[model samples]
Target: MCPRSFTSTSELLSPEPALVEPNAGNSHSLRANRLLQHAIPPPMLPVVDLDPEQVRVLGCLVEKQLTTPQQYPLTLNALVSACNQSSNRDPVVSFSEEAVERAVTGAKARGLARFVHPSHGRSALRYRHELAEVLGLDERQLALLGVLMLRGPQTPGELRSRTERMARLDGLGEVEAELSALAGREEPLVRRLPRSPGQKEDRYAHCLGSAIRHVEDSAPDEVRQRDVPSQSPVPAPSSPAPGAWSEELAELRHEVARLRRDLDELRSQLGA
Candidate 1:
């Protein structure tokens, strides 16, 4: 298959210009896109089922690209630091370069990321995420996904707070609007998790793959301290509602789909 074209990393690193509406001349491109869409079958679309490590790696790439543009295409060491950074990340992890490299390779295979060589006198290869382009996400959508990937499930308010560095989410409404857009995609990328007992808001999580268990535990300590005001401790419920398990079942189905894809790829490789 031909490589998918998207905004180049260099272009992303450049200053943004004024937004303009598409002109009539671009109609040919739109027609081509529609024709290509019909030409490709649903099964031919790449399945996005990133493991937790891959999620963190891709999240770091997206976050760094927007937040630290001067160092957008991160080197291996830099990406490692971003992924393991004590701040911002929930359930802080210490991933080795090898682990990160493997995740990067997985993401590349999924067309969510790519490797690049740094310009100038530098020689080390760098990496950047193509998620925004591949997923057709705007800045707000990318910000929410990045935060969800890094921090795990969160309330809309929490997302708005954390994504401030990456996008301007004026209020919970804007966040919800964008979240709705993401969830409404043909292949949804996000889902709203069931509200826990005593919680006033529903937490949202990315549906790229299996859930990250550590993040499912609770909000980050810093987030709790900063955003969640202290309140009386609420007792844990004995059991969840019967229907609450439906979402979890769906998540398992996603994992199964990913496993099936992997098995198929292996069979193809072995020519079985």
Candidate 2:
């Protein structure tokens, strides 16, 4: 059966279905539980399983809305830029505006996003995500979720650092607390995967999409690409010496400057 489309904001905000575990050996209670499960259907719920492109679109919307409110409800061009950003994204993509629009359309059908036609002197259509309102998430929760959607699974430390621009996650403890809150929801939004080999902390992935599963399955390939040089058969390069960090840092600074310039131009276009 097809999931029902959310017709309005109120519909999207519908309360979560309550699931009570039946008491062991209570036949009557078990019967009632079975009936309740059938009565409260999953198809009518707001949950939508997004593809990778849709996940990226929704994540970009959530990110821009929180980090750049004046530029909230981003134009298609700006959203494409956000989706293709170099920093704060894993497996950075070069999505065309058509691809982004298609993703946004898919998200809108599932009630995760809304599209606004050109209005009141604005000639370009803008897009926004309804996740915060639909899922009852705060800025902190949405920020973390956005990062998980943009990047693949991440540890609490990674989340804390990456979400700094969108939300202030004070420390690892705070990040974990928020993650726990997300995972504890009736329809869990995030899950902790078993820690990978050589990793001290467990990584968390968003449950709204199957992209993470694909990411998990392709882990070896990702590792190979990062660790192996295409032209050489040498083992993975060892960590750079202390002196080499300066060069990496300088490159990062240059990237940040470029990003800032792009952001400034976008802001101007948005009249922010």
Candidate 3:
């Protein structure tokens, strides 16, 4: 048995190691690279929500624009005129000069508006509402609503006549159509009035209280504020600066001087 051993060259050599090519799919290194690419989430879109008082103030501003397109976007004086003309009787949501100032300040703080002081003149001061569209009204509709709200109730014909005095409308038919559309929307802000005999026209009332309620219900809790004091009187302006004339007097004097200068220039031109 010891004599049977035989050595062969091929048999004695060690076999070559099996080839291990790198995996083409499902590799740990590839997965780690993909994970790194998706590490952070995207940012969200911005949301802007306004409080009820802010909403009311914006509505008033839009109404002013509607009534006096020539004077819009309204200056403080134009705003005062628009507010006064809106109602002869006292207003339920009357905005005093101080109130307007406060509201404008608050709105600016919220990044919703910008306004300059009256000392700079109307042109120097301007106010804008970023969420005007959220109130669901155009300037014309707002003005119409303000007028109707102030005067209680009015026929479409009456609205057309009154609005036409301040604003240019295509015709009574257009006014009627707008009123009908508003009524059809089932909006809590508008209430229809019964037609009377001998008057073929339909009447409408502005349901401001209902509108307020609707907004309150829809708004979030944080934006709601305590009710304004019911009997707060608008503060009177303090006496003018010492040795300074009233604004009206100063304006009149300037006008007279301008007229005199104009007259002198005309006379010189005519060689008189």
Ten residues in a row with the worst lDDT in model 3? 1-10
The global C-alpha lDDT for each of the candidates, from Candidate 1 onward, is 0.80, 0.83, 0.53
Candidate 1 Cα outliers beyond 4 Å, as residue runs: 1-46, 212-272
Model 3 scores a C-alpha lDDT of 0.53
lDDT of 3 by residue, 1-272 (tens): 01111122231132423333435794775666556534424221122233534545554565555555555555655554445554532245556766676765665555444564445354446565533232355545656665564554678778877776445557888777667655554433455765544568766765544443342232233223323335778899998785566777888999999999999999999999
| Cα error of candidate 3 at position 198, Å | 9.2
Position 81, candidate 3: lDDT: 49
Using lDDT, give the best candidate's number.
Answer: 2
lDDT of 2 by residue, 1-272 (tens): 23343434456556556666778788888888778768964442345578889999999998888889998899999999999999888879999988998999988866788888889888988998988866778889999999999888999999998999899888999999999999887667898876665789989999887556434666656766766667856698799998899999999999999999999999999999
Model 1 lDDT tens row, 1-272: 33233233333334423334446789866777667656743332234767989999999998998898998799999999999999989869999999999999888866688899767977899999988766777889999999999988899999999998898989999999999998876667888776655679998888878554333444455455666677998998878677878888989999999999999999999999
Clashing pairs in 3: none
Sort by lDDT, top down from the best: 2, 1, 3
TM-score of each model, paired residue for residue: 0.63, 0.63, 0.41
How far off is residue 197 in model 2, in Å? 2.4
